[model samples]
Target: MSGPWTEWDHLLKVDPDKTLVDGETFEDVCQTGTDAIAVGGTTGMTEEKMATVVEACGKYDVDLYIEPSHSNAVVHDDSLDGYLIPIVFNAGDISWVTGAHKEWARLDDDIDWARTFTEGYIVLNPDSSVAEYTQADCDLDAEEVAAYAEVAEQMFGQDIVYIEYSGMLGDPEKVAAAQNELDDATLFYGGGIHDYDSAHQMAQDADVVVVGDLVHDEGVDAVRRTVEGAKDA
Candidate 1:
């Protein structure tokens, strides 16, 4: 409650288009009526790219956060509000459990951990590249997902519980399932949310609807459309 999460609403996730310039820039992205700006990508995140994006975002008045792909990727600067580290507890491996965190602690800067964002991090049974590459054993039914949510809240003491469908489109049922099963945890949904209607459906139970790829591919107009759709929903 005290750290960087003083307020919350729809978030706009930044995409890494190094060769391109967002006609909007930080001012433009923030102007799209988003509550906050999330800066990070699962892959191809260079320090230079991260710095440029964060610096650009600083010109805007909205609160800013970074989703570090890993410990090395986190570039701590005075402008950042805090970090949103996704803990994939259901990965069925301890590597993402404590091993990954231990590595991050060695960073030169101290982590301004606002809230431990615990995610169900479910990889669809058919399999996505993220699950396969991370070696996540994500063959879970709704029951298992709910159980994971409970543990993530009680055992891990997480303030935010995210139902993530990484690298592919999200399933509304899956996200709603996890949201229903948890208690006192801020619910979040992300992945493949392209339009306002889809964003609305995803936002039904989610406290935050993250739109990343759309911003990367479509541009500011897309961000405005999506944010308007989400707010009106």
Candidate 2:
């Protein structure tokens, strides 16, 4: 389910030293325009680093969550908001999709999940890490994605259907097309959105525009601009 209308993916590029906000320094940074904070990335997301970042967001009192890289990367602890599991029937993979949820209750810690957001992830960027990691078949076809978007909400009851194109630039045309085809689900668009103009275009069609690397590179204040632009859009 969708937790809030607006959310922030406060993610960094795996390496801690390259991290924009350290584990203990995310409170004030997170308060600027953060309705919620989501942790996790495609790279060096060591469990320790994830814990550190989660704990840091916890310090800020913002809604803290993680988009785990894999099933085993989850921290069965109290510092997280919940998890967003990517489920793509096209890929024929279900581990990161529903498998993680099946065994969540049996973990060491009593995970306080706010909501489990089911997403039909669209991998548009060919050489993206997420594509490689998941071994997703990325053919960048509009009709292909439209069909998936059509079923994601009604069939799977997904909270969101994400039209994502990772790397430096996302495809707005594909995202817009998918947005038009979806049922009663919140459409989320991320990746390749580095500026307000691109973000606004994507935001125009989707329910939410998630710009993570923008904050990491441009700082919280700059991200705030994107957030403001998105809201105004």
TM-score against native, each model: 0.87, 0.82
lDDT per residue as tens, model 2, 99-164: 655765466264445555656787776687777766677785778787888888777777678766
Q: lDDT of model 1 at residue 2?
A: 31
Candidate 2 similarity to native, TM-score = 0.82
Model 2: worst 10 consecutive residues (lDDT sum): 8-17
- Number of the predicted model whose lDDT against the real structure is largest: 1
Clashing pairs in 1: none
lDDT of 1 by residue, 152-211 (tens): 777777777766675566666667788887777777677677777877777787777777
Query: What TM-score does prediction 1 earn?
Result: 0.87
Number of the predicted model whose TM-score against the real structure is largest = 1
